[model samples]
Target: MKPSNGSTVSQQSALSTPSGPSSASASAPLAEDDPEPRPAVAALPRHVFSENEAEPEEGRTGDTPTLVFGVPASDEPGFREELLLPTYEALRRAFPDHRIEWREMSKFDLILAVVKREVDLYVVSSGFFAYLTHGAGSSWLATRKIPQASDPEHAVGGLVVARAADDRYATIADLRTARAAAASSQSFPSWTAVLGEIANVTSYPEHFLGKPRFTGDSGLSVVERVLRKETDVGFLRTCEYETLVARGLVHPQALKVVGERTSEALACRTSTELYPDLVLAARPDLSDSVRRRAAAAVFLIPESASGYAWTVANDFRSVRRLVARFGSAPSEHAEPSAALDRYKYALVISVLLLGGAILYSVSVSGVVARRTKELVAVIDEKTTLEQTARVSRERLSQLERAGIVSELSSMIAHELRQPVAGLVNYADGLALYLSGKQDPVVEEATREIARQAERVSSIVERVRAYAKGKSDVRQPSDLCVVAKRAFTTFRSGADLTGVRVSGEFLPEAPVSGDPLELELLVVNCLKNALHAAKSSPDGHGEIRIRVSDDASGEKWCLEVEDNGPRIDDAKFAELSHPVTSEKFEGLGLGLSISRVIAERHAARLLFRRAGERGLVVTLLIAKRPVEAEDASHGTGGMNGMDGTLAAPKAVPASHYGADPSRNVLSDE
Candidate 1:
């Protein structure tokens, strides 16, 4: 599910940034409602959608392989600057439960970076992609050129220009003598599709005005130079052009629109026929699954209106056609390498095959004979390791049993006695004061004793299952009952100190997880969510939890999403890979242990990402029936597939759902 439009960043803020400094005065002030720009996201977590519901539009009838992408820098100045960044950011923000990473490098370096077994994806300009696939690029990608993720034929190219002017160069012919610049001559829609064609008509100055001038230094530089009149023109895709115009870099009338092209109505304009821009290309040798995932990511981008939506998914044929026609644009890849590769395989093969036949056979036989002994050693070692694992499992099981028992006992004491103790202390102290001091002081003390007694009772009531160390529990429970119970159980004195638990749930939606454990999970998730949100740039951020299922079968996903700073891909990977931080407190055990519990129920654990901000942690539990056990709410009449189960619809107010807003906070 998507967050509220405000929390997610309104299109207005994104569309209205002033490019030049002076425009601030003439430009409207920041929204009155928004004294300071709202933090990217709110601090509260909203689960308007429950974990046991289907995602808004993800109809998962089948499975797709995972795909990887390799890109250069993060967002940059202009046209070419952040093309992949937002796409990457949006992907992370929207689909927080997938695997994606950026291998950071200049787009120009992708020519050498993409090999049969190298990166699974390369997000370069369409023109740059054309150069690689011209020949063996097929060997680099596959037998033929293909669209990165989408179907190529459906993809369109874009044209970036200074906004159109009433009195301006009317056509490419008119601008034939104009000095136009671009982020790169090799940029997809910019130079390759737009200005490069213009170059054929324009007379080349011996220098960029006087020296070798190129806008490819950065996308924004081109726009900047054009605005400064250093270059007469600049090019960008419609989306990018909109971004610049929004940012106030160039006015709509600052430059002339020499051309405009479109693939659909109400679509962003382009200078040339639209061709695939950022593609999810596979390393010539990626597995089928990887390729599929890569494609899905691209296709799904545009699903949510506010999601990082792509216009279309393209196929290989049309993409190849464009690559063939455009050929290679001017690029820096032609430069010679400073380092040389050495080949030692030939020498080794010659020595092994020719000179050492007889001698090598004798040596090989001896080595093989010795290896038979080594195999024995390896098998023995493996057996020992297995044995150790068994012993460790036993010990760990004992420890878990002990921990649970101990924790339960502590909870009981803590719940039943703490408030009682407080009451006793207050009463005793007051009795002494009343006898020896005054009536008013005794009355005040008596009130405190009553308050303490009530507080203790509240704890005892919520922790019934925890105190008993049993899974048994009865329920006529509604969503509010469960939430309030959990909240009271883990009550913290300060609202800000603990997590703000705020998502809504459908009470009528039947769910099967153990109510006690489920409550525990929610509380734990709330605790973590609050901590994580507070640690983020959007101090008080929003966490969205949603549940739904479609063609992929029933799934219950709890997403603790935050647009806080994103963890580095490397660190994120480590956490996901069953990593252990020996002395790490709070975060380490929580995620690792929670993951174990989720998997036991045939659920998945995932961490979502944002652009260098916040983390979205999700527990995706399949709704299929469990073969081993029945669901907890057996009478809810939920149908089961395998051992997992799903109700006809979420229990009213008990089944959870959520979406977030910008600055403003709402309970429902």
Candidate 2:
């Protein structure tokens, strides 16, 4: 917009005005003929800005003139609103006939929006205003006047802070190895001013402190890094530091000011030269009445208004001087069309040079390309033949191993059967004789002999089935029955002298698997648990076998826990691999074979530490179909003495293990 003298005033021209006196800096004297000052503090309705807020309805109609003010660039979304809400309220009251609207956006976005005429006014940093006026141009309407308590003059300084306990750095020169953090690269006091001070000492300023970390856009965020020891030092605006301490956001004694710059105008400790605080800018074409009213309304916002007040716009030459010295502003001299025109000749020469080289290279390599393709095809064919030969060799090896296992199984079955049958016959005859004698000692001996015979016969049957290549017949069986049977046999017959064995069977734990195989799995786990417990530091130890559903209720767990020395986490897998046992006199194949059986039943066998002193082995299987329903009614089927049971239709079963108090099954 042109002035009354018919000359257009650029943004630079506006900022070039003589510096206003510091006392009148809070409220620049507007036209002498404006309205008298109203009370600075006025109460008004508050509106919170969020994604859910309804758009202001006051300016929708064409009758009331609407003015939109853009928020400044700050890390915090609420920084501008918290400080400017009171000022906005005052403007609404002063211009009751008009509508006032606030638009929230980032610093860079706000600059672009105002320059493009998308927004009418903006609260921006002095450095930003200077950079804008240097190129795209800006119109200065008013500037904020923070109190001398918060800010001494129109300018604010940069504060460099380090931990109070850190004694390595007393000044900026001592920051050679220190890591630096700041609000952002765009912040003047946090970044540009500090850079200006370092540039005066050395040309390569990075040599002084390496690269600085832009921690975040908020002053508080950068300060937090220093206090948390995440960074060695922090830089932020002097006013920001004072304000944080005043508001109890941070404690003053926690941080020490380094390389403190003394300024009578500055009421707080700082490190770098002070630059102007945030300034208010407006579009050059804004109507005179709106501009005047806005300028007046801002000045009326009182000190009790939470530090909200405006002074005459200060000459922002200090900001320009710093920016020009440090070369911090983005390039503004390039025009795409002019740049293209200037580089066209060089572009033509480069394209011509590249085309000639490509033509020569293609002419020389045509035959070589064809030969290379032929070589690659021959190599691929050879690779394919090698892979096929390797597969054939592996198949033949597998067949040979299968044949050996079959022959071995048949021989074992044939050799073990005759002795097993003879042992059973002899035990039966002994039992018959002992029954007539009715001697308790002879009767017990005969019973043990019969049990051993039965065990031999069971092994013979299992070997015969496998020798004939017949898979074990799997049937829906109650696992609780299988677990109890195995526990009863192991506790009665195994030589566990000092070690105590215990079992808790949850009834109706149904699973689909071979009952004999499941029994073998349980027996091996129990025997191992007994051995481990006996070898533990206590010498006399306890083993507990538990059968229950998992937390998910979809899986069942058969867990055997023993009070044994815990295995380290790194060697748990080694226990499952076949290795000769140091304690037992055979290869350690019991647990490994049990794992195979578990896989056959679509289950997993896992070993883990139980509490701090023992190991627990768990076999996880799919839950039975009716398990959940039975649990709700407080019933898990009854215990059938025989191991054959599909579903339990009765009450829960009893515990099955040898009593520790009894001296039966001694090691001797």
Top TM-score model: 2
Q: Write the per-residue lDDT of candidate 2 for residues 557-624, one digit (tens) a residue.
A: 99988898876764665555433344555445577568778988889999888888788999998865
lDDT values of the candidates? 0.48, 0.66
Q: Tens digits of per-residue lDDT for model 1 on 1-668?
A: 23311112112222223445565422322221222322211211111211132222353322322234566542333322224445556545444444344455655565556633245666655455555555434222211112221333434454645434324555555554466676654556655556344544555412222232465454445655655556566666545554444544334555555665545522555566555545445555555664555455555443332222344434445455545555453223443221111124656686778777878789999999999999999999999999889768855764576577557766676666665666667776766667755677667767556555654544454345344654332322222333433444444432454234454333322334544445555566656665566666645555544433423556655555655456677677665643344233642455555665565455677776755677767766554345323524444543211112233243322222222221112232
Model 1 Cα RMSD, 1 decimal: 39.6
Model 2 earns a TM-score of 0.40
**What local lDDT score does residue 573 receive in model 2, on the 0 to 100 scale?**
54
What residue pairs clash in candidate 2, if any at all?
25-311, 26-310, 26-311, 27-311, 28-311, 28-312
